[model samples]
Target: MQGFHVLVAGVEPTARQSVPQAFRVSEVVALDAAGLHLLREGDGEPRATGLAPLPCLALFATPKTLPLMREARAWIAAQAAAPVPDVVLLDRKSPPAFVERTLLENLAAANAALAGSALRQARRVARLRAEVEMLGAVRAGLDRFVGETGLAQLKRVFSTATPDFETQIELVHGAPLRQVLPVAGTGFAAIDLACTGGKRRGSFVARLTLLEDGEVLAEWRVPTPAQDGWVRLGLPVAHAGLLRTLCLVVEPASEKSPCANLALGAHQPLPAAQLGDARTGLPIAPHSLAFRLYAAVPGTTPPHSADTLMPVAARKAKPVPYALQALPAEDLARVAETDPGTGGPNLLFVADVAAILCRPGAGGRIRAACPAGARGLMASVGVHADTPSAAVGVLGVDAGAAEPALQRVPVSSGGVEEVSLLFPEPLREARDILLSAEAVDGAAEGAWVVFRDLRIYT
Candidate 1:
């Protein structure tokens, strides 16, 4: 009567496994409990044959009726001496208006009481432990208190719990930790040359702060060898939170000495940024380089080609031509626009059109290499039209395979949506693959699809 139990009925499909077969609406006309056995009678009073074990029940309006809901609540009230149910599963989909309101109100009240009891119990245990430690002995008063409040039962139940209460419930409500990504490091070339003859390596500190409140989330330091000319300080910023705005404080090896000319990169496209400050002008303002945040999930296996990634400034210096034919260059480019610079500049997609066919004369295919061990590709895509039935997918091809693996993406006529495509098991070990899009429903050519920030992560 002091522990947690859930009430479930047959009508709730998801709670079916938790409910006993005897208590299902179809199996029982009346449900009564005798010790651990739930007496389920079919259209009659409980009989000896109807006795069955039921450890839990989850009550819900399964048949969409008000009477059943009331009956379930009444049964729970009648079992007040028994343990109060801790979890209530309510059907949110299409319930009687009054039943929905009543269920939510009662469920809220019960859960609030449960939470309060748990908190008080925790405080009581802590106080008893403190008293035991101070007195250096277990007191009779403590024993009596524990017996009266069922503290022993709580302890026994919690001893075997995996995560414990605080981690599972309390800490989950706390602020989330956002991951910080390493974008670029100030190589500090000339500063390294000047500090080389002194003593130690020259270092630079980069700070990330909130623009609104100026709260420092994290700071990173990159060290460069003083004698190295083309020093590339690959400093990784390992912090978490919603990050924005960066500040760099240059440090020389010696005190009271001016730092030499500092450079930011030894790599191209070294974390795009703007140098000027928008706020009040200051000395730090002259030195501060503001950059946008780029967050990427860490992956163990690198993609075969990250050559075509997001925020691409222009077509690759050596453009890999699409294995395309049939459609004229202008129409083909217009139909499936690959150059991101022409439109909204970060994503890759087929241009929006009133209608476009996917026949031999219209559709084209683009091939991209997928190295072995590649598992999946993730991308944000949107397909929209005046009507429905828009879709896209990535095709994976194996070296000796007769057929290529295809992952088709269906798109609604709404705004943009995120999509993911998983490669087949055989194709995961494949060396080459093709990514293509075509009209799924041949009759409808009005569909338009766009894909943005496509990445293949292992």
Candidate 2:
């Protein structure tokens, strides 16, 4: 029977054999006083004698053995480490059926409580590990930046540092939002916009474009911010001379939900700076968005163009294959192996490539050293042909930064689709890059999502 374990401490040989048959127990272990003493010691030596560290229920055969069980329970309680097993005294007066029913109920409750505790502990550990890694990445980034550009040369050229906002513009899909501002100085390298009301649901992409004199200077595609704060986008073009007017365009790449709001200041008619929609040719408001512009000091080099800019779609680059079979066993366990509600692998092969299977409530993660000159990640994601429900999978990559590059794709049974996401910054060293996948739909009977052909493109 599929049930929890029970420890029959100091039980007779005949009684020990009957314990498993009396009730639905996966295992019934018998132990003497010496073994009980070993358990109290907490040295884990009882495991060698076929004893589990924690059992759901413990039964004493007679009143004589009750004292030892109580002592062990007290010791465990004092330690405050493991859960104490439910103690039961098996006397001659009690009926066998009643005892059996009570034991089963207790076992179920104990098992549930233990499972919940373990899950909480695991989540805590995972969260702490992520925080530590984030801190380490921040330290590494600061060290690299300061080492390349001296600390004395780093300065903010312009900033609106205001807490009060006149109005807020809600960013939507296909609206073509633009912020026009006149530039009177050179060496501006980056822009930071104050934003609010961004709550991540599935996955969304936000594009930032810079234009001057009707010419495209640089463009960037980043994951929509999951929180409300200042969003920074680095510019790669060199501003060698004074520019007359610069236009900043912010828009959604596609029809995605849950977008951010740009904070705007009070209207000013003299500066000729305003917010408007490029499609309608009408101004939304006669105000400039709250933003900060950063620039490099004289004699210091600006951010490199090749490293910060996203590569063109038509550019030729070699793909470095990352084999799934080479992953360690522990990493493999994090992903779903068997098909949902079935024992099969739910194998799906596309172009002779094996796909990794995932289901609702189950996800996968892969960690590897960042390849030299790596610019982006490419992979194929889809649903199996026999899938019973529709699925949407969100793929993300973290290069040890506060924000991860993200992409959301709908998985269909008809055919596989490919997606490519560029990293925010190019890696200079062999830092670890983490790839993650998870289903975002609310289907209880989730479909089989498959991923294959993962590679790094330079």
Candidate 3:
């Protein structure tokens, strides 16, 4: 046997899913994904019935968690080898084993063809009209060739695999798993997947890697005749939000088994950076932003609010102004302890293109609109989300001063983007207050703080 057909067994208590199942040391082991299936002796061999003998692997599980940790060891006592692999390869079952046959048979044929025509000088091309084609054992044994290049050339030698082998692998690996916290996780729990497969379909391969930024990169290759599902893979890519998209690629491979792992080694977090158009010292047009406001003065600011509004139609190009403003210490008038700014007195949350949307008013107090409809007036920070992970911003407003109240300006389209300091019914003065915008948050760095379009009612 190439590898042991592993299984696990166990039972759920009458009430709780947590709290180990009552009694016994050998109740669960092998043949199940979650260590919850019951395998029994039917017709002389083990057969699963979801009742008596739950089947599952004892994967470093607490002996308290496994009723069968010891007995299951006794059961598999004969075939015992190295109990654990440096890496465990997990797979869902294939249909009637036909899918496995298809994959292996293709591999066999591919190997058979390679011994003859692949080394030929003619560079002959052949088409794989068969969907269940195998690309078995691409290359090894050649001392001069590295594993990847030989495989790539082998794919080229085959000539007829359609969207190409590497591409196909990428396609399969990219089947979107449910999003996870991206940077760190141990198993599927890092994602939003159910413990049991929901009507589980087809077979796929999973490969894991780690980036410098502590993100666990799970690259999966899923092959099927037709695509209809995306099992969630748990990973979150910092501010780079499409992290799940990066890890999972869905592709159409005829057979069910993976010939080789689509090992995408050492993925790095997309470095958040600034893009200057040259010549101008002012930050470039930012993709998004995140900014924060620190309330300098201590008073009943009544929880200030701060959210961004996308103004329509920017003003015509204006000449860039010169010389950085001196640290306006007076500007810190209403503020308390201020953290030394990063992103060069701009970006927040680190290394990302961002800027500060500082609105310093009345004693250095910054009233920012909070996220999730964070009502009331308070200090706040958030993204200038034209896209995810692309920005940062900070607002500086006055809490002690009674001037800038909350405002609900209506968009021309009739929806409200919620501008601040426009409440308390004194409509005229709210609009007249000297409102200044600037780049302070590191993430929203380089955004052109131009006067853009606005059509507000309240």
Q: Highest lDDT: which candidate? A: 2
TM-score of each candidate? 0.30, 0.32, 0.17
| Candidate achieving higher TM-score, 2 or 3 | 2
lDDT tens per residue, model 1, 310-407: 11122222211211111111222343423334333222334342222232112223343344555555445565555565665343344454665556
* Model 3 score (lDDT): 0.26
Off by over 4 Å in 1: 1-203, 208-217, 223-247, 252-281, 284-290, 295-373, 378-382, 386-404, 409-434, 440-446, 452-458
Instruction: Supply candidate 1's per-residue lDDT for 368.
Output: 33
Which regions of candidate 2 fall more than 4 Å away from where they truly are? 1-152, 161-166, 200-212, 241-244, 297-458
Misplaced by over 4 Å in model 3 are 1-373, 380-458
Using TM-score as the measure, what is the rank order of every candidate, best first?
Answer: 2, 1, 3
lDDT (C-alpha, whole model) for all candidates: 0.35, 0.53, 0.26
Candidate with best TM-score: 2
- Candidate 1 overall lDDT versus native: 0.35
Alpha carbon lDDT at 45, candidate 3:
41
TM-score of structure candidate 2:
0.32
- Clash totals in order: 10, 0, 108
* lDDT: worst 10-residue window of model 1: 152-161
Q: Which ten residues in a row have the lowest lDDT in candidate 3?
A: 151-160
